[model samples]
Target: MNDEEQYSVWPHGTPVPAGWRSTGFSGDETTCLAHIDEVWTDLRPRGLREWLATRS
Candidate 1:
């Protein structure tokens, strides 16, 4: 769930893979969309890439 009232750019419904980020957009809407694209560029699905990589 969205933790804040601000613009939340997290993938909903569909299962988001790991390494993906949940940016806290401040309700800018336009900027949020752009941010999403930027985030997507660097983000990869779970076990696909290392963004916030963790070792088990």
Candidate 2:
């Protein structure tokens, strides 16, 4: 993402946190929500939701 892009926690040049990451260069203009969700899940494998899912 360029400096003009908006992010909640990812500030300008903030390296992606742990597994919650992106190269910040999804230039294809496609909404990467699912991709992002995957990364978020990876970052919180022990998270409640992910833990419950793994049990299913």
Highest TM-score against the true fold, candidate: 1
lDDT of 1 at 53: 65
lDDT of 2 by residue, 1-56 (tens): 22222222454455665545445535222345544554554343355556689899
Pairs of colliding residues, candidate 1: 7-27, 18-46
Query: lDDT by residue for model 1 over 1-56, one digit each (tens)?
Result: 12221223543454534544444344455776876566555444444444346542
- Candidate 1: lDDT of 24? 35
Per-candidate TM-score against the hidden true structure: 0.33, 0.25
Clashes of each: 2, 1
Residue pairs whose backbone atoms clash in candidate 2:
1-24
lDDT of 2: 0.45
* Candidate 1 TM-score, true structure as reference: 0.33
Stretches of candidate 2 above 4 Å error?
Answer: 1-8, 23-56
Provide the RMSD of all predictions against the true structure, rounded to 1 decimal. 9.1, 8.8
